[model samples]
Target chain A: MARNLLRAAAALTVATLVGCAAPSLQVAEMGSFHVGGRTVTLSGLPAKELVFTPGAPPLKLDPNGDFEVEALYARYTRLSNPKAKFPLLLWHGGGLAGTTFETKPDGQPGWENFFLRAGYDVYVSDAVERGRASWARYPEIFKSEPFFRPKKEAWELFRIGDTDSYATDPARRRALPGTQFPVAAFDQFATQAIPRWGTNDAATQAAYDAYVDKVCPCVIVVHSQGGNFAFNSALKYPQKVKALVAVETSGSPNPDTYDFSRVKGVPMLWVWGDNLGKFAFWERIAAQQEKFRNSLVRAGGKGERIVLPEIGISGNSHMLMMDRNSDQIAALIDQWLARQGLRN
Target chain B: MARNLLRAAAALTVATLVGCAAPSLQVAEMGSFHVGGRTVTLSGLPAKELVFTPGAPPLKLDPNGDFEVEALYARYTRLSNPKAKFPLLLWHGGGLAGTTFETKPDGQPGWENFFLRAGYDVYVSDAVERGRASWARYPEIFKSEPFFRPKKEAWELFRIGDTDSYATDPARRRALPGTQFPVAAFDQFATQAIPRWGTNDAATQAAYDAYVDKVCPCVIVVHSQGGNFAFNSALKYPQKVKALVAVETSGSPNPDTYDFSRVKGVPMLWVWGDNLGKFAFWERIAAQQEKFRNSLVRAGGKGERIVLPEIGISGNSHMLMMDRNSDQIAALIDQWLARQGLRN
Candidate 1:
């Protein structure tokens, strides 16, 4: 568990850059849909589909006597690149949806584009109760009202700057020197922010697992809180996931109890951003991930960690996909995918 | 100096959102320029001007036998909004250039547009030795060679995540859950990275002051390291700056002995991001800024601290201007300006 395998392996990355080739791009298909869950009885209330039409009235059609509340919203963009070996499934973190991989808050193309350009058939999804994934009423089906993330929590927890800085007026908000987060586009970043409840994790995990079952035999790219779901899913269906890329993920399978040996076939990678030591909360999170990765390797599974700075790349935040060099980071993944033979 | 003003500001800030009014906008003017510096002699060689033209050839012209090395590169955008306010000058943090206020690496319109749309002419500048601002050979004209910022240093110092995370693989990087930074675009952020030398601070500060002098009676928005230049400029020419808005500024006027009353006539605003306590480095920075602000207030200057979180707008990083909600932050500044009667 305490091995510094990298220093001696010679594979300990020194310094390098991802590919910058702009291949002939072609989009095969792009659209969105709902996945997971079925109707269940809720106090004997009937299950119904509610439809709202713009410039028109709302309508409700009841089919089953059971309530449906856990279907997740998802969008997939597949490229017609003949060089692609496997489709890449993108799972976003807590309080956010597939938008995390779509267009940036500042209007730039997201990882979906980068991966597609790199010959990936990409699938982006909104977990249950996030983004396009509609949520049921709280205190009824949800059991608890959703708590909105104030801007303060983000400033403190996200490592954007000192927590006290965000407490200042918006005009006075100071970014840490050399910070790569597009501070000017913070409002745009917040547009992707949604209300999240601690009580929804179980439901979210279930829906995500179902998503994996449906989109198996594909590579997985998970971010932040999505890390947990990806880890759990890979454990459940190892053969389906050829390779796993976890970006700034916070969740992992319980290292003490989980049998990581099952995931031995799946090549796993974990990427991190700049300043981790600044935030006390991330210490435990980092430790958790390290334990999980170590457990996998000890069990004969392959795993690698790439700290942006250690590799000579820096200034990335938790939202690396939206960072200025997101394309470069994607290219790094592309390179890794090729090495793993996950790329054609 | 250790006062927790936010906790006491319950009545100071309630729940309120920045303006979201998208006004009819028009581009009145846009152009770039070089500002400040005098010709200087280096060694025994005569100074020469070297110019490079696209699709043509490079030209060197010797005129005054003196070379100008530290003039900065600047871009100005003036919008034709009839409901105009005082022009705004945006000073970026250290190691960054005018691009900080221009288009985001993610391709979103920058704060320059938001300010222009809000009826303020804006000037974005690349300090000397940064961006388009040309540099001279070290030990000849300049004293020391520039030092490049590695990826690891950026990750830790910038507060993106833990160093261990970045040291993993690029794909394995894990952002803290709930962070507002665009981690995907980290490579994009790295693209802006350049070599910085500690010896150049004075020259950079001098160039910034000169730029302010050239564009006087304008509102100033300074971030991080730019805080030093903004404070010094305001102190020297308080009359020229109708108002000063320092965003998460770490540097300040010499609080111990400087004449704190000289700039009392100019209205000032100090803004901060969230989580100062998390980063130990920021504690002193926050303290420095707080001490300076208090001294200014005691000197009869009108100033206030706007903490983004204390006001319910959380999740902003040091680079608040490039954040998704940058426009909202700008709107807050706009509102404050109107209150100060800075509007035309």
Candidate 2:
């Protein structure tokens, strides 16, 4: 059936390419699914009338019901002839969805495309409560009300600007000197930020574990908040996880509390972009993640940490995948994967 | 630059095609952005401690802030050489995101892929407060609390099952006889349902108008509740909307209230699946939409309505795009587009 589809796709390609360029990649299949959510029933909430459309009579809005929330949503694209040993999963960071790995805020092709071009089936996901992974009623299924990430917080905390550099006016918001982030598209980047609950880590972790179980024996490329999930998933399912790529992971397993030996056999790569020392927050995060990496290495694990500046690459911010030199960074990761025998 | 990228893609294709099938299609550019949102500030909300991680100390969660909300999120893929004269914008319905057009509940490739393969640049959007377009604080930025769609409501209201056929137990649930919807995947279909608000039609419509302004002189394929937005958009920007394909649109502008002549020059196609008349609710929706269609035709507009049974295609549910015969339905739409001179 797969071969037949490929042959048909090839024929369609010919018919469709009359005046077009040859497609860059031949996809065998593409699809998406929601995984790992449990149902929760709520009652006693007041009912109201909902005007679903203008001029239409209202429909009864009943709040007492069984709702399914906290599922992880993943969309995958598989190449007809994949060159990688395992599929690559792109997981986004805090307050963002899988869109992090898609198009950059500056409207450039993102890592999802770059990696697909480099010959791996790609799966991009929205972790629990983010993007298409719908959020539950706050203070109901979720323990706390969701928190919104303000544009100022994103600018300052994401290492795009100095502590006092973010201003209400766009013209006054100062980016770090020589920053690689597209400062002109800062507002565009801010739009991807969604409401995130502070207490859903366990739910998020469970959904991610379900996701890993559903589609693994694969590679996971994680960023920021996703680092914790990837590390936990690897620790929990070492055999299924082929490798780990952490991009400036913001949090990590407490090296003193968790066992790192389980992932010692899993090849790992940690990448940090430029301008890390500008903020003590990033410095702290880097230090904590470095300790975890060190612990993994100390346990006889094969792990490599790449600080872009050390390799003569500079001026990258927290959003390396969306940075101006994102392709360069992806190339570096691709080379590392190739060295790890991930390529066919 | 495009030529260079295409040449480079072609070169890479050659090197990568050693044992792999040729890629199904070539992509020239892919990207996403959020559009049409205004910033709002809130104050006097209480703060709390947020336990972001399992073992970490809680961070102070301050609710007082300025937030960017009610934005529309859209992702676009432009082919290397698109075969359509204009790009195709896919607008999803209520309680769902662009994922509606992505992958079906049964893991099948969906209309997005079908259209893309048929040679149109596809743009799929999550309307305001849906999917990647984040929701705002209810009863604050929004006028009312968001409502959740229960699984039972979906099964009955979407024409997947008889009104009394829904059961709490999966094994006991009964699909309408000969329904094309994959009954086993009904639970999977429910996962795409998100929290939809009651009083946000204005916000939703405004965001959609802004979206049309940003990305039109193109075709629009809408589903379910998206009918209202597409109709309003065509009415508002008649020249920009080359054509419209509305599948099971749940609501329409009251023919008595709105001027239909505005869209007289735009071609329109309304598709209805089988089993629509199984419930009075669906019958009412179809009748309302049919009246609007009739009004369009009476105004000298070019419009066609295809009831699946009338075309000798039967056993379809309201979720026609996700039905077993989804590809056949997509093929029908493609043929219609070709006949309408939408093809290159």
Candidate 3:
């Protein structure tokens, strides 16, 4: 009787402590691409990829921000590549969102044409505010996220973009309530969308489970703070993505400085602007770049900080979100992929 | 060396699983009210006394479903008993939201008149919609709360108005966004709002703490399904709210009935309606009421199932939220309050 009582007490103790384990997530794969100079071959498209279905409604941009626009990519609808070494997932930088990977620069075909042509099946989405999804969709998508506060305490306040990140037009800001808090939007993306899109969200989860179930060696090439999206998503869903290329982007404040207790691993590439600090204004990100990289490294991630030297013009790294330095960045990514034995 | 390793392992395990013990909620008393035959009071008010601040923007209800009225006692800036009971934070029923407590019964005042005249401060907010704040300011009032699903799932699907309850909503036949598998909105409420309004929400934790730093006998009165809100909020911030009055409500579906869980400890009251249902509706509630009451009883909380038949009217309980029956219900509440030994 005494032994039985002790066993029952022990069992009750464990149940109270663990309650239930966070469920394991099974990630989906959207196949890989090959990067040959400029012409890209596209492969294995996960039918449910976050793209406008061909002949589907054109992606609507929040009317408030001049930064947003969605053009239905007719070709993306039929693109598919199976049995590739790695699938390409397009990630956007903070303050800017959308599938359109065009950076702010002259003579660049935006990363959209860059990756799509490189034969890599790329998937892109405006995390909440910046891109195409209606702003009204927010309160639901970020259902369980807490208001990230003491943000002044937990994180180094400003992220990829700050005061300058706001839309100039009052109408645009009106269109997106998310504008009220841009950084909160990013945190929601990493903590909410990552688990949900591929696994947690019921609607998206089923699509993921049916298509990309655990197959890895995928690449997350993110622009800006979308760097966190790629890294956190991969970290939280490691089995789904392997190598990552953060194109002209700095590391997110999650892995090292913030309470990302909700997110956890994945190898990463820290492709930051070589002249991130050149900007007279929001040059603070450059200061934290080293700490960001070191944190990811400390947390069992393979991260490299890439700050491209001068884009065609002498400017700051912030412009990289819309910069025209794809060919150079693409090559660097190609090199990274080659080393990872990832296709294309 | 082996003992040290074992000790380190045990400590790590405890730290990871247990998390910090939820801080004890320091509940204090504010003021009281003798109403509807019962006397009730506020708990966890910021000043250890019933504090009322005036001068809020007036309420607006031009919407087709809601009637227009000045909620501020003929639009008087604002008034508080100062020594009155804790404010009754009212939330709208599921589909209908904040409109649930509006007292527009053709002539007499709504919740505003009933409570204000009675000397208790009332906070009726449109927990789901944003624009309503100027007039109704209910809800997350958390770091950022969201009492109901963002777009009013409860109102559209489970709405129990003067005529309908979740039981009667034809839409209930179809699965709602968050309800497809039958999880209670209560869980979603706690998961989201607690982070914002309760001590859990990082943004508002300090505010919630500071606000409730003094004494409170805070009494939360939730009508209909808002009971879920009252119950969950009290569970998460028990120190902030001392007593919970679930007027005309039963807890949401629990794990024993479905796959959901029940909240622990808050006292509850389930007032039945005579104006509702064909005799069958009340019978259904009667049938379900026992199980609901039994569940709370087993959880170590006191509860009661009051029927309108107990009063002179056959079923006046359903009229409790309106202007007509407010006084009677108020009297009964006064009686219950006196029993608490809480006096103003």
Candidate 4:
């Protein structure tokens, strides 16, 4: 018995070392690229002498030149042995970059790792004017100054707390009851937010279209503002889009104006988290999406919605992908994809 | 003996499964933030209607608004059990973002993974007007329009080939004999290059200063144009900066104008690749750096230079980190860090 216990201890040590040392997946290919933007020229601007470094002589700076703006950047990781039928694309929302799907603020493995482990080639994109997709000059190329989101606004808008619950002091801020979001990491989440423009929706859509043209026959998972782009892309290229999964989509196409019949063959799933009914803003957005979904179903399209609280999961914020039960949600997504015959 | 062999096979199978299932490291914390940009307001721009989606009516777009511009973006990964005494910050060069240290154009793991595996926390950054650090309005806030680098220009400028070696046709372009850069992935490397403004150097330097102030008493690894910022930063905050590593630094302070004595106590390393003598531009740059290095050493500074070819490691281009022998060079840096007493 003593010998058996010693052997068990030795086996446990080896197992622990192996578990900490190995990588989660074997990556076959990984790289990044930019797609879709036009070049613009600016001439007749004045030249100036500027000091680039301290104690150095000023150098002449020429202002007239041609520039490239509004391009979309995408980074992809293809697995050595993928189990899915098609590649997966993860898109982020307003004021955020492709980092939305990366490691979470609380140091947890995000959906990117979860999906990669589940066996899919994942492509995460920084759309026009966001992240590595550099922005254009405002009032000339971009047509407007960029807008910034304050921390207070994010605290309320993300459904983490009621409007009155937020305070200047962290200790005073009260999150919704049983919130799944890692409230302690709220400041960390805020760091991912960047300035966004109100006038570049058309430019952003064009870039997303170009991205879809470059890479298609793939599945798309979008959140918030990305919903409009993914929805429009699927409508425009139904044959290329295998499936669409939207998490708390902030906006959708107007069903009365757009043709839902164009995407009858495409399967789509809409996911919503808990405490959505606590605010009128979310209620209005939900009503609009419900109307759009109803129209699509009537037009013979495969559209489905999953409300987390109704299905026994609770206390999730709008940023559900970063929530505590994020893995559970990812499992549901994997199960849904398999049911749709997406498994290899 | 047969039973013992059977047990061994079972152990091997278990190890293999565990190896493929675990992550390389346990992360203690990971997140990102933006730093150093002033707010500006723009007015009197024309309002326009934007067609955000196909078959939908145009939405009104107001161009007048307050804007935030010229901020730098930084992402960090802190290991649970760090072996290095200080965090490592990786800064990129002109026309490139933090992606320079990520996956290589050829799909092999880049320096980010290499140093992470070496047991140090890593911080990667996008300097002002690059990547997630969005650009400002040209001829207004920026004072110059951006400049784009043509593929042929990058081919010659990066020292992958001679000026006469670049061609419009891929098959015709010739790399220098025994080049270590993955010539086949040349086109892929071009994707990371973004438009840069010549006039924004001051803004860029200011942002870098802000970054250093926020994250200091740290080690810095810089490449190309990043050389100037890293050098200036070290000179200004010598106590905070433990060491500086410059890889193929394209620019440096004039030893006649700047004082190198400020960094006398800080250890520094200047790394260079092969075939630098093939171009007069590179020769001039090398002379400047050599002068600066000599001045630092004369000032009782801990300065060292490593020419790859001199060390029997040849065939490297300006982008040594992305070259095939990148891991070998990383091992060299690791050894240097150990020698500096940075190993925990």
Number of the top DockQ candidate = 2
Clashing pairs in 4: B180-B315
Which model is ahead, 3 or 4, in terms of lDDT? 4
Give interface RMSD, every candidate, in order: 25.4, 2.7, 26.8, 6.0
Task: State the number of backbone clashes in model 2.
Answer: 6
Give the Cα error of residue B120 in candidate 4, in Å.
8.4
Off by over 4 Å in 2: A1-23, A43-46, A49-59, B1-23, B43-46, B53-58
Error of 4 at B338 (Å): 8.4
lDDT of 1 by residue, A1-344 (tens): 11322321222122111122332244433344456644443444444433222334434432322234566655554554437688899998876666677666565556876676556777877777664455554455676544444455566567777657773245777776677777776644653455455567677878888878887789999999889888888888899989999998898877898878788999999989887877777877888899989999999998998887777667777788887767667767777778898766
Select the stronger candidate by lDDT from 1 and 3. Answer: 1
- Over B1-344, each residue of candidate 3 has an lDDT whose tens digit, in order, gives 34433443454344333223322111111111100111112223232111111233432211111111111100110232222446555544432333344433232334543444344555544332211111111222212222222212232223222222323223443322221112232211211111011112222122223222332346666665445545545555665675566666643444264311233434566666554444455456556756766777776666765564445434243435542345455545544543443336
lDDT for predicted candidate 1 compared with the true structure? 0.66
Report the TM-score for the A-chain of model 3.
0.49
Superposed model 4: Cα runs more than 4 Å off: A1-26, A38-58, A64-66, A164-178, A213-216, B1-89, B103-123, B133-220, B229-243, B251-267, B273-285, B299-302, B307-344
| Clashing residue pairs found in predicted model 2 | A23-B25, A23-B26, A24-B26, A25-B23, A26-B23, A26-B24
Give the local distance difference test score of model 4.
0.79
DockQ of each: 0.01, 0.40, 0.01, 0.15
Residue A240 accuracy (lDDT) in model 3: 72
Give the RMSD in angstroms, all C-alphas superposed, for model 3. Answer: 28.5
lDDT of 3 by residue, A1-344 (tens): 35433443454344333223312111111111111011111223222211222344543221111111111101110123322366565655443334235322232234544444344655544343221121221223332321212111111222333333333232332211111123322321221111011111232222222222332346666665555445445545656766766665554544444533322345566655433342443356555655666765665556665454422222223434333333445555655565666764
lDDT of each: 0.66, 0.83, 0.37, 0.79
lDDT of 1 by residue, B1-344 (tens): 12333332321232121122332344333344456654454445444433222334434332222244676656564554525556789888865555567555454556776666556888877677664454544555566544434455555556666445564244777654455556775545544543445567677778877877887778998888888888888888888988999998978767987677888888989887655666788778988888889988998888888887777777666767666666657667776777789876
